[model samples]
Target: MSTATAASKTWIRTSASIRAYLQLMRPANIVTAWADILAGYSATGLVMSEQTWPPLLWLLLATTGLYAGGVVFNDVFDAELDAVERPERPIPSGQSSLKGAIGLGIALLGLGIGAAAQVSELSLGLAIVIAIAALLYDRFSKHHSLIGPINMGLCRGCNLLLGVSAVAEQTQMLWFLALIPLAYIGAITAISQGEVAGGQQRTGVIALLLLSMVTGALFGLSFLPSVQGWNLLPFTLLLIGLVFPPFLQAADTPNADMIRAAVKAGILALIVLDASLAAGFAGWPYGLVVLSLLPGSKGISRLFAMT
Candidate 1:
């Protein structure tokens, strides 16, 4: 074989390997993490004008690392289950080795925590907490009936809070607001499981609705005078209004697809609300909101269409 051909083959193999790794990280699933961080930052209403790039970069890297850790470790813990439920998964299918997954998990955890440490001690602390929670959920909590989703939700909530707490002084209200996304995370977790189980329970649907409402309320509260302006009241009301119909529908039928659809719609509404909050706080007029929502809507639409 020619030297050039050999090099091309090598490159192709490398590229394919990297793609598998990325899949293991589950990039599509990290949208909720992004939304959580965006929501937390929006609540603060304090966008840095001069030194924004540094914090934003740190936040992105840390979040990506942490999320990667979660995915890798979850696969490691679920290897046996995946053999039965999802043999095509990375570990079960031999697309990625178990050792590779565990090593990657540790590396990503370190990178995430290190990146957050660069931002602040508080951020670093939160990163550690999140890492621990992810590990616990993957190893143990995931098997527990109610505790699994709750633990997963808290992990996501902390991931968002880590971003905000990294940039600004911590607030009590921020902790309270974190519960909103926690609820959404719980709902999503339940829905994903329901789909796998081939049915949905009314209790699960009710839990999801309560979580969605809390999430909307928290988003609205972030725009209050304490954070931004009372003018945001209209936007908050609109978000809550947009969020309710889907939940009501899902409440009756309680299917996996319906729950997923409701979550998608809720995410779209959040993207809009957060972008608006970011704009309101940053003194930009509508540009950020438009930019954020367009891609978000497209992504969510594609995700649900597949399901």
Candidate 2:
């Protein structure tokens, strides 16, 4: 090939490589991770404050690394499985190399920990825990029917706590709030199991029940004295509206495609759930700010898979 032709081919190869990595990172799901931090920070009543950007920005970056690392490792670990069940995935389809995916995962995880360390020891510790939980789910727990969902949930819960670490006292007092995401993500994970092979109606029903409990908790939290002025009802109702139809449909159909749709809706609805939490703690304005991420997340989901 001539010099110009060779250079053009090299540029095309580089562009394709970049797109493959982005696919491995699942950018749309990473947006939901940022929502976790915002919701937790809002609970500290510091989301919109003047000093918010410094720490909040770090946490957002940290979650980008953590969530991206977790999902990348997921694809890495499942490369063999993907070749069999999802031959179109980056690794299986030869769009991304396995060795490069491993390197990317390690670097992103280190970035997650390093960014959190810049915030505080508490944030660092939570970031470490989140990383460990993510690895656990990716490597071991994800294979277990009972532990897989809970392990994934723990990663998300600790991510929320990483946000709370911005305020030491609030972190101590409000750690229990992490359980809400735990249950919500756990239900999503459960629904995800059916995404490949199809799941039973019983599994979908269980997920719906768990989601209902999560909604109830969100509504109850809004009634607390500290959040008395802001109403979480609108956000909570929005969450219900976003998630329920697909969830119910999946329960009725229980097919791989329908289950996948339900899982996608659940994952996207997570941003709405985080918005409700933010609005409940800080007020509707901040809640709307968090909710604003949804449009971008949804748009990206169209290009990159969210589940």
Taken over the whole model, the C-alpha lDDT of each candidate is 0.66, 0.90
Candidate 1 lDDT score at position 261:
69
Taking all chains together, the TM-score of candidate 2 against the true structure is: 0.97
Report the Cα lDDT for residue 130, model 1. Answer: 93
Query: Candidate 1 clash total?
Result: 0
lDDT (10s digit) by residue, model 2, range 1-307: 8999999999999998899999999999999999999999987877667988899999999999999999999999999999999999999999999999999999999999999998899999999999899988998998776799889889989998988898888999998888899989988888788899998998888889889989888877865777743457799999999999999999999999999999989999899999998888888888899999999999999998876
**Which candidate number would show the highest TM-score if scored against the true structure?**
2
Clashing pairs in 2: none
Report the number of backbone clashes for model 2: 0
- Model 2 regions more than 4 Å off: none
